[model samples]
Target: MLDRIANIIVELKAVTKEAKSLARKEILYKDELKKIKLENVALRGQNATIIKERDQAIKERDQAFNNLPLKDNPDNRKVKELLFANKIVCQQRDQALQELSIKREELLKSLQEAKIAKKDRDISLSNLDEVISKLEAYQNICQEVKSKISQGKRVDADLLIEYAERLLFEEELGSTSERKLDYLENSYMFTDQASINRSLLDR
Candidate 1:
């Protein structure tokens, strides 16, 4: 009977110990729940203050905006006019730049054309000078030939050699004969010195 009582006492002690542990756990859980509730109340107060400040800031900014001038003010109209004038000036500047570019291109083209024309004129003048020199040499040779024959003088071999390549046109020597240059070169008056002497004496 004593053993049975002791077992019953032990079981009762275990039950009491478990109940105390559960009580301790319940007290800790209640404390944590109270702390969480306090933190939530603090957060709600902070949120309410932030909302009030935001509302006050918005109201002040709106009232300040209402005190400002409207768009129809004189100063605003002047700013608009200045902006329009600036736009017009920019357009005119662009147009002038475009015209300047076109004029520069035209000037360059004209310069190139004038340069080409000048070059052609220079070539033509050189050719005319060469032709004129040849014509003058030919005329001198014909006159020497005529003079030597009429005066009975021996025409030099050098003078005959020069006329080998020279011809007298009707426009140059006023001769109506249709004789070519080589035909005159083979004539008696323009041959060797012996032929020139005989031809001159015969004249």
Candidate 2:
């Protein structure tokens, strides 16, 4: 019975360790989602600014073209030259507007992708929250079992701990290690667990 109690304690420790890891991963994912959202907003703003500038350029080009005298006159050469210059300016403005349109389209696509990513992040965060809550509840149950053990109670702590361990494993906490690292690196708010652990150890 003592051996069983010891095993349960060990299993509880492992579950708590995994819970910590999952919490860290959840934080990283949340941070990354925030960054993606911010980038998406910035890109949208840039697209709007580019569109406004393109429209202004088009209006100015049209006004310039309209101001030019296209009809043949006494100063035919000057008129022709002005018309030719106006055409070149209009062409250049049109090209710039086309490029801006293409850029705006690309930004829009990127924003859409970011939105999808944010949704996925939110889902993952929700799952993590659920897992964390379950883990906390299990931790409390383990504490109760410890109290029972201390009081010379005959609770099946071993079976309870084993069930909790299975629950932890069922959550698939280890699967997010790579994803956590990826988001940690890509996220705007930098977080380094190794550095944090080292600092804590140093203290």
Candidate 3:
């Protein structure tokens, strides 16, 4: 019975160690998600600025075209140069808007992925809490068993030890599951961009 109790304590220690590791990973993933969210927000702001600038450029181009005096027979060369410059500016604005649109789409996709990762992290944390609760319950039972043993009671501490062992095993399983979920979620996020780019390149 003593040997069993010793093994149970060892197993509990291992489970707690794994739980701590999983908690650390959860924090890391949460930080990464925050970074991605910030990047997405910045990209959205940039896209909005690009759109506003494009609209302003279009308005300016229209105004310039309207202000030109066609009947003045002015130096057509100057008019032509102004028109050319306006066209170039308008084209540049259009290109910038187009690029901004593409970037916005990419950022939106990344933001969605980050949200999913955050959800996974939350779930992992919830599981960890449940495991912690179970560990506390098992610890209480072990204390009771130790008191009985001290009183010279022929208590079957084996039952308490076994229960603790089961609880510890469950905790380990939860930690493993959480780790796997985190890994899979992160892997999907990283690979999604690569997969899309590969398909585009192929096309």
Top candidate on TM-score is 3
TM-score of 1: 0.39
Q: Give every collision pair in model 3.
A: none
| Candidates in descending TM-score order | 3, 2, 1
TM-score of each: 0.39, 0.44, 0.47
Worst 10 residues of 2 by lDDT: 181-190
- Measured with C-alpha atoms, the lDDT of residue 131 in candidate 1 is 51
Best by lDDT: 3
lDDT by residue for model 2 (1-203), tens: 34554556566566666656766766686676567667656765765676576667657755765676766233666558666766766676666557666765766676677567667756765665666655655555556556755866554333454446755667563424364334222321223655534533542
In terms of TM-score, how similar is model 3 to the real structure? Answer: 0.47
- Per-prediction tally of clashes: 0, 0, 0
List model 3 lDDT by residue over 100-176, tens digit each: 67766776776677577667756765665665566555555556556755866544333344445656675363434
Which portions of model 1 show Cα errors greater than 4 Å? 1-83, 152-186, 189-203
Clashing pairs in 2: none
Worst 10 residues of 1 by lDDT: 167-176
Of models 2 and 3, which has the larger lDDT? Answer: 3
